[model samples]
Structure formats: structure tokens, C-alpha cells
Target: MTIIATLIVLGVLIFVHELGHFMAARSVGIRVDRFSIGLGPRVWGFRRGDTEYVLSAIPLGGYVKMGGMDDQVMERIEGGAVAEEEDGAAGEGKVQPGRGSADASRTEAVPSAAGRRRDSDFDSKPVWARAWVISAGVIMNMIFAFFAYTAVAAGWGSAQADTTRLGQVVVSFLPEGTEELEGVPEGAHFTRIGDRAVEHWGEVREAILDAPAGPLTFQWDNPRGEITVPMPADAEERRRVVMGLRYWVEPELIFVEPGAPAHRAGVRAGDVVVAVAGERVHLWSQVQDLIRASPGREMEVVVARNGEELSFSVTPSSVDGITPDGEPQTIGQIGVQAQNPPITYTRVAPLEAVQVGWSETVFVTGFILNFLGDLVTGQVSTRNLGSIVTIGEASGQAAAEGLPVFLSFMALFSINLAILNLLPIPILDGGHLVFLGIEAIRGRPVSAEQRMRWSQVGFFILLGIMALALGNDFLRLFGL
Candidate 1:
């Protein structure tokens, strides 16, 4: 299931990206030769007009072969026959969009003679035209994301976190044994977080949720001192474990995820938590601790559905996770979020959804850019780097949840794909843009030698990143 979901997701994103380039090229009169899906020798395809549309050996990404372009690095990346073009144009490889041979027996031609650069050739086009061709993929990905987000918003409504309301500020989590927190009560108010005066939950997300994983100090008035605790890097765990803001929290079940232990045990949203394992519980922290302590153990959960209390048996599932120590360990999971005192999910009109979608698109773009900057500046750990394995796992999980959730995940991933391609590294869409920019400013292209040298550097950098991400994935998989 994971593999299938991953493939489908990747295939859709890749197709949209490459299709952008293909359409842009044709619009600018650039004759495409080979339209290959994947990155190796032609597996199957048919010729149409001047392009030969074929499926290739590798099933990762697609490419198009355009006239008057020499992609040595791409050819090197793809290897073998994919590098050899029909017009003796060797080293003309595309990453996910490239060219091909036309049928001479029919009536179509290559759009020009094989020996000379034609007016329809990509190199013969204006700088703006070439730029359009190169950047179309990224643009399309962003557009796809926008539409997907808008659809989700229209269908399921946007999930706006309640930032103003305060509940269980300290009871959600209390660092026991810390000298400063020794006298602090369970429901004590927190005045500050990381030098920021947090009057509400908004600032908490910025100070703790958005901050990189590390030892962070907290001060409560009751204790009148500070205690340092390690924080998780991921957002999901940070909400539940670090902040204790789970739904069904506040002693009321606001959300009960389908197929989760709680839901399977017949728990539903709006159920007031009465007890767990027959032990009376009021604080979400106590509930979390109880559930965490009883991994894979069947226990009774009591909730107030109406005027009377109801009980159901649920067994917590154990999964690999981390704590403040950063060491991998088994922890119990019930798959739920919090329900505050009150909650609502109001579906928006199409127009409002569009506005919401645009806002989300811009916000996500900025957030990803900021995160990358942090990564470059060493504010975030490299251990957060993930590979295809992590994405596949997430794909499967999201799909299992439901369609709207799956689309939401896909939208986020598509935006990520677009942004990553805009990085100024060679061989990527961003790198080509850099080349074009240099050409436009200097009135000449960067010499092939220089381009090749930088491309090699870029390729190695990508290889290193891939290795690191794969390593992290394996470590997580094996509970390292």
C-alpha cells in the first residue's frame, strides 16, 4: 500500500512538472524531439508531429529532448542511450523534461535540417522565452498546489487552530524533579517562552513548536525558576507530547481519529473524558502519561456521552519514537488530537476558499524558505533530512486517513517540490535560471567548460544530500 501510494503521488507530481515544460516549449516554437517518461532507454512510445513520446527504463521522472540544448550533466545522470539523440545531438539529456526522432516514412520532419540550428530551436529563442520554458514546471506545481488547497478548503473547511483560548497550560506537561518546577502546580500559567511573553497559544507555536529541536528552558511563577527540557523537531509530536495539546484533551474529546485505538474502542468526538483504565482522570497530561505507560495493554476508557458515563476497552499501539534525550525508543500512540472547550469546522464558499488557498500557498512558500535558510545557517539539525522512504510512509498514513487528508498532504508535498527546484544549484530548474540570468546580464552565456565544472559540483552536492537523507530514513526504520 505504501509503495503504491508513493508511486502514484510521485507520478502525478512529476507529470505535472514535466508537462509544464513541454507546453511552454511548444508555445515558444521550440521543436521537441523526444518526450520520454522516466530517464533511460525508450521502453515504449509513439511519434506525433515532431516529438516521439516514449516511456523510459527508469520510472522516477520524465523528460523532453529540445533542440539546441546540450545537457551533459543530465546525460551523465541518465546514462546510456538516453544521452544519444537522433540528430547526433549527444549529451542532450533532460531531468524530467527533454526531445526525439520524428517519423520520416509518414510526413513529419525534425522541423529543420539536422546540421543547422533552426528558428524553432530552443537556443534560437529569446531569453524570456527560454526562461519561460525552464521555469514553467515550478509554476505549474505551485498552481496545482493552489487548486488542491482550494478544493480541500471548499470540501472540508480550513482547520484554524485556536490560539487565543488557553487550557491546561501547565497540566498538559510538567517537568517533574526539576528544582525550579518543584513547587509548580499542575494548572499554573506560563508567562514566557524563550524570551517571548506568550499571552496565548500563537506565541507558544513560534517559541516552541516552530523552534528547532533543542534544550529549551521554561519558567513558571509557582516554581519561580526555570527548567530546561529537550524538544522534538517534528510538528506532530511537538503538539501532542511537547505541548500536551491533544484533542479529547480538556477532559473532552473534540476529535477521535477513525481507525485509531480510541475510535476503534467506540470513542467519538464530543465525548467527555471521565477515566482511563478505570482510573479517574481530569488532566490531559495524566491521560497521556497513562496511555504512554500502558503500550499495547488493553485498558478501560470511560467517557461521558450524555447524562451517563460509558466505558470501552482500548489497547495502545507501541511505535518507535524519541524523548528529550534524542534516543530512539518504543512509545504508545492512540492517534488523536485535542478537543478544547468548544470547536467548529465551517465550510467556506468557493470564493472564500480561493482566498484561503492563496493565503496558504504564500504562507507555506515563506515557511519552507525560512526553514531552508535555517538549515543552511545551522539552526536546525541535519537529522531532520528525510528520504523517499519517509515520504512513502507518510503517503500511506495520509491515504489511510481519508481523501481530503490525502489531498492536503499532496498539496503540501507539491509545494515542497516546486520550492526545492528553485534552489540555485546547477542541473535543477533554478540552476538553468541562474545561467539564463547571467547570460542576460553579461550579454553572453557561461562557457560550456564553466557550466560543466559547476554542474559536476552540483551533482556531487545532490548525491551527498541523497545519501544523508537515506541514512536518516534507515536509522529511523531500524529504531536507531
Candidate 2:
């Protein structure tokens, strides 16, 4: 299931990206010789008109072969026989006569514009036309993400944090470093900040930040909770506090992976974990800590199910990982999910749904960009980088949840694909655009030797990044 879902998601995204390039080239009258969905030896294909459509063996990436593009070196990586594209126009330019499809295609060769140097060749096109062809792939990916998000919002509604209570008031997905938000008492929620009643954290932050630099009295729901906060005078500190606040999750199982140790031990979803190894646990973190400390050790687990206590003995799987400070370590996992703070779903009209979709797209785009920046600057851990392995795991988990969940994952992954391709690395759409920019300024394209030199450098950089990501995946899953 995981492999199937990962392939489907990647296949759809890659197809949309390559199709954008193909369409833009065609609209500009650039002759495309081949359209392929993967890189490597051709597994299957058929020629029609001037184009040979192929399904290649390697599924990591794909390409469109255009006339006048000197890609002999690229052929090594793309699975195109060296100089095959140049010979595409020499012979067999027409589809063979057939019963069902002969009428759908031209039976004769397409007329050449002139001996080899045709105006329809990619090199003959102006810089602007070439730029459009290069950029269209990223544009198409972003457009797909927007539509997917809108469809999910309109059909299944948007799910957002319902922070009306104390337990569900986490503000950030992951908090930042060198930051501590003290004096956040548990089991206490803000009844009012100043004279206004506050249910959301946004309201609480606004009231606190807008006030003068002084202690602010906060009214709480509990009788002994009229605590005063010595609000930070620094504006950035005020913002950081708002983002750092979070509550521990409840010790309830929301999911149990089929065939996992927990499931095999008769542990099921909706079970409220009460104790582990004879130690009482109230919060999800505590339950996880106990489990993580006992890898491959049979331990007693007590859960409250339907007002009756149940006991089960389960051993956790151990995997290698890095701690927050970058120390190598091994952690135990049982393939169970704790209930994340509850969410509320609301229906929206067509126009409202469109707005919601666009907003989500923008928000996710910014979030991804920020995380990438942090990862490079060492604010985020390198261990977090993932490859196809992690993606397969996530895809399977989402598929198990439901269609809406899967679609959300698809939308997010689409945006990620678009942004990654736009990085100013060689062999990517952004790299081609950079070359085109130089061509436009110099009134000529870069020499083929220079292009090849830079392209090889870009290829190595990408290879290194992929190796790191795959290593992280092995650490997370197989402890290799």
C-alpha cells in the first residue's frame, strides 16, 4: 500500500511538471522529439507523429527532448541513446498504419522547415520563449497544488485547531531554540486578557503585545489562577512566546498500525493508556518516554477501555536516531499514534472555499520556505531530511486515515516538489532559467563546454543531498 501510494503521488506530480514544459514548447512552435515519464532504459513506448512517448525504468525524474537541444551528455542520465534525438527527424517520423489509430495520426513524414536548421528548432526560439518553457514546469506544480487544496476544502471541508479548551492550545507545530515560555500553568485557560474574554491564543498574544511594557494580569478559569505575566518588552520576544506555547497531548491511542507490535498484542485504537511498566502516566509524553526506554523488553501496559482496565505486554521496535543536541541514539517505537489536539471542520461556499484554498497554499509555501532556510542555517536538524523511504511511510499512513487526509498530503507534496525544482541548482528548471538569463544579456547562449561543466557540478550536488536524505531515512526506519 505504501509503495503504491508513493508511486501514484510522485507519478502524478512528475507528469504534470513535464507536461507543462511540453505544452509551453509546443505553443512556441519548438519541435519536441520525445516525451518521457522516467529516466533510464525504456520499458515501453510508441511513436506517433514527431514524438515518441516512453515509460522509462527509473521513476525518479523525467524530461522532454526538443530539437536543436544538444543533450548528448544528458542522454547518459536520461536513458536516451547518444545522438538519438538528432536522428529523430532523419527517418520514421510518421506512425505506422494501424486499424484503430492510423486515422488519428499522420501517415507521412512532417515537412521539414529546411535542412536541419529549422525555425521550429528550440535553439532558433527567442530567449523569452525559452524562458517560458523552462519556468512552466514549476508554475504547473503550483497550480496543481492550488486546485487540489481547493477541491479538498470544498469537498471535505478544512480542518483547523479547535482551541476552545486548555488541552488543545498548542500554537506551533515545532517550537524554536533558545526559547522557554515559563509560567504556563496546566489545567488553566485564559478566561480573559484584560476585559475581553479570550478563547484563542491569537487573542491572548494581541492583548499581551499591545500593552505597555509592564506586568499584565491574566484571569484564568480556575479559582487560584489570577497570575501576572511579566511580559517581555522586546517585540520579537513577545512573538516568540506566542509561537512557543504548547500543551502536552493526552495519553490516548488514535491509531495502531496493522500488524505492528501494539496491534499484535491486542492493543487497539480509542484505548486511553493509563500506566506503563507499573508506572502511572497521565500525559502522552510520559507514556512514550516509558516505552522508548524499554526497547525489545516485554513490559506491562494498562489502558482504560469502556470503563474497564485492560493489560497487555508488548515489545517496541528500536531504531537509530539523533537526539536534539546531535548525539547518536536509539529510540523505541510501537507504531501507535496519540490524539493530536482536536480540530473542527467547517463547510464553506464556493467563493469562500477558493479563498480558503489560496490562503492555505500561501501559508504552506511560506512555511516550507522558512523551514528550508532554517535547515541550511543549522536552526533545524539535518536528521530531519527525508527521502523516498519517509515519503512512502507518510503516504501509507495518510491513505490509512482517509481520502481527505491523503489529498492534503498530496497538495503539500506538490508544493514541495515545485519549490525544490526552483532551487538555483544545475539540471533543474531554475538552472535553465539562469542560463537563459545570461544568454539574453550576452545576445548568445553559453558555450556547450561551459554548460556541461556547470551541469556536472549541479548533478553532484544533487547526488550528495539525495545520499544524505536516504541515510536519514535508514536511520529512522531500519537503524542502519
Candidate 3:
């Protein structure tokens, strides 16, 4: 399934990119000899007029072949014209049908302008037109990315942190273990921390962290009631208090493994873990910590089911799992998964998709560029770079998890593909555009030797990056 999805995504991206070049070439009156999807041996193909369309065996990358684009090939194709012979034979029939002198006279006639135009046509096109023809592929990829992003944003909505202010007190997703003594519930409006009003989560955390050791007071209100809790006497102990609450964000419970702690404790799909071990549970991290701390220990679990408060005792069990840093650890297992928040779609007028799509396309392009820059500068690690194998693994994991996750993964991969193909290097659309730019400025195309040298360098650089990405993938996959 992962392989299929990856191929489909890559194929669509590549096709859109190639289509850009094809369309631009046709628009500029440049002849395209072939437009191929994929590479290597043709699985299926057909010639239509002057162009041959092909679906190749390898489902990775594609290309467009244009007439007069290659000097040597164009020369051969143009010089091999049998038109003079045919025209001579026709003319000879009028003079003397079977005479050798008739044929000799016909062979001496000048070649038509049409034949010469066909041979030198593409090279004769304006530099600007040629540049556009070469650059169309990258432009199309950008356009595709924009549409895909807009579709996802409009369909699924965007994820953003809540930035609303009420007072000095801020609402939390889950109560910290130390904050548990404060008796704050999830969704509780914190009005004041000690003497200061809390306006944001950051402020709330700061106040908590900087609180005076003795009897720190918190003023809050929940749907049921308002209350205040006092901090402990020990300043160090108070610092250890974990406010496990998260800001209010909609998320679904998507999966529950059979016989797992969550299942055994009667936690089912659609049940929200409102609080765990009396801590307001906001994100997965808080829930995970609670489970990890109480492995094999029974604790009170509070869940919100269809607007009803339900309480159950769950005994967290130890399970073997790999950490993000590639360390094996025994962590508490609940065998539960969360669903992505539901997306609210707003249908727009047809024209809006274009504007929205364009903005999204530019944003994605910029984002990819920034990310690569960061990676190169060591601001981000090489581990963040993923190969096709890593993408497939992610897809498989998401698929095993649920539909929302899978869809999200697909969106990310699509954006990544669009960005990666737009890099200004030889063997890419950007590289071709660079050559075109040189031609436009110099009034002549780049020499084959220069292009070949640059292409070789580009290939080596690309191979190195691929190797690093694949190594990262292997390390992640096998928990190395």
C-alpha cells in the first residue's frame, strides 16, 4: 500500500511537471518529439502525429524530448530528407518518365524553405520563448503544489495554536502532576496565578516555574465550578509539579488495540481521555508520561464519553518501544491512538481556488527552500532528510494507524516532491532554466561540454544527498 501510494503521488507530481514543458513547447511552436512518463523500457506507448507518448517501466521521474534541441540529432534528421529525390522523380515524369537525365535534373533543384525551417526551427525561436519552454516544468510543479495545498487547507482546515487571552490565567490541556494538587481541570479558565493575571500558556508556565515556594495560589473555573489550590511548602517540590493540561484543541481517539491497557480499562474509540491519574490530559505526551510512570500500577482514569464523565481504573503495562533517539526502552503501553481533528470545509467560488492555490504554491516553495537551507547550515539534522524508503515507511505506519494520518502523510509527501524537483541543479527543471538563462544573455546555447560537466557534478551531489537520506531511513527503520 505504501509503495502504491508513493508511486501514485510521485507519478502525478512528475506528470504535472513534464506537462508544463510539453504545453509551453507547443505554445511556442517548438516541436516535441516525445513526452514520456517514467523511464527505461516502454511498457505502453503510441505515436500521435509528430509526438510519441510513452509509459515506461520505471515509475520514477519523466522527460520531454524536443526536435532541434539536440544539434547533432537535428542535423541528421534534417539532412536525411528524401524530398528532393521524390520531387525530382515527379518533375522527371513530365519531362521523360524513364530517362536518367530527368532524375539527374530533379536532384539538382534547390531544397524547399519548409525543409530548412524544420531543421533550424527550434534554434530560430526567440531566447525568451526558449526560456519559458524550459522553465515551464518548474512553474507547473509550483502550480500543482499550490492547488494541492489549497485543497488540503480548504478541506481539512489548518492546525494552529490557540492565542486567545482571557486574563493572567490561561487554560491548560492537562494538569501537571505537581499541578494536580492545584485541582485544575481541563478547560478550566485560569483567572490568576498567585497575584499575576495569566494571558497565555507561556505566561502560565513562566508563573508556575517562577512561583514562590510557599503556598502559591491559583484561581480557576471549570464548567462545574470555580476553585483555588495552594502550592506545597517545598520550592523544589513545587517545581516538580507537572501541569499535564493542554490548550483546548479538537482531536479524536481513532484506535484502541485489543487487550491493551486502554482496552482492558474500557477505553474505546471516540472516548477522550479528559484526565489521566487526575492530571488534565491535553496532548499525547502528557498521557504517555502518566502511563510510563505507572507501568503495572492501577490509577484512576477519567474519560469524557458523549458529554458524560466516566471513571475507570487502568493498569498500565510495560511494552518495548524505540525512542526517537534510537534507544530501546520499556515504556508504558496503552495501545491507543488519537485521530486527527475533524476539518471544517468552506466551499469557495471557482476563482478563489486559483488565488488560494497560487498563494499556497508560493508558500510551499518558500518553505521547502528554507528547510533545505536550514539542513545545509546544520540548523536541522541529516536525520530529518528522508529517502523513498522512509516515505514508504511513514505511509505504512500512517495507514496502519488510520485514514486521517494517511491523508496527512500524503499531503506532506506531495509538498516535498514539488519542492525537491524545483532545486536549481542540473538534471532538474531549475537546471534547464539556468542554461536557458545563459543562452538568453549570451545569444547562444551553452556548449554540450559545459552542460555535461555541470550535469556530472549535479549527479554526484544528488547521489550524495540520496545516500545520506537512505542511511537516515535505515537507521530509523531498524532502530539503530
Measured by lDDT, the strongest candidate is 2
What local distance difference test score does each model get? 0.68, 0.71, 0.58
Task: Compute the lDDT of residue 295 as modeled in candidate 2.
Answer: 73
C-alpha root-mean-square deviation, candidate 1: 11.1
lDDT of 2: 0.71
Candidate 3, superposed: residue stretches over 4 Å from native: 70-124, 151-185, 189-221, 224-282, 287-338, 342-359, 393-415
Clashes of each: 20, 0, 22
| Tens digits of lDDT, candidate 3, 1-480 | 867766766777778878888898889886665676876555787878777677766676676656543322122212221112554543211111221110000011112233454532355567677667766776776666666656655564442323212221122322233444334555566667777776555455556677765556667655434444555555544434433334444334777755566777788988877788889875655666678767677888887898998898887765444443334456665667776433334455556655656665566657777778766766555666878876665666767645544554555555676567657777555665677778778877777667756765766777798899898666544333
Instruction: List, residue by residue over 394-458, the lDDT tens digit for candidate 2.
Output: 98888876787888888899899889988878677777778888888998887767776777787
Off by over 4 Å in 2: 82-89, 92-116, 161-163, 168-248, 253-280, 285-336, 341-344
What number of backbone clashes does candidate 1 have, counting pairs of residues 3 or more apart or in separate chains? 20
Please provide, for model 1 over 1-480, each residue's C-alpha lDDT reduced to its tens digit, 9 standing for 90 to 100.
Answer: 778888878878877888888888989888776766676567777877767677777666677667655555566444334444455554333222332321100011122335676887777788898889889889999999899889988988765443333334433253432223333345455567666776544455556666567666665454455567666666655654435432223777655656668877788888877798878988666677788878788889898888899889888877544454434556676755555433233578989999988988998888888778767876555766889877887888778767777887888889999998888887678877898899899998777677768877877888899899999777544434
In terms of lDDT, model 1 sits at 0.68
User: What value does the lDDT take at residue 94 in candidate 3?
Assistant: 17
The candidates, ranked best first by TM-score, are 2, 1, 3
* Model 2, position 37: C-alpha lDDT score: 85
In terms of lDDT, which candidate is stronger, 2 or 3?
A: 2
- Could you tell me the C-alpha RMSD of candidate 3 in Å? 13.5
The TM-score of predicted model 1 comes to: 0.63
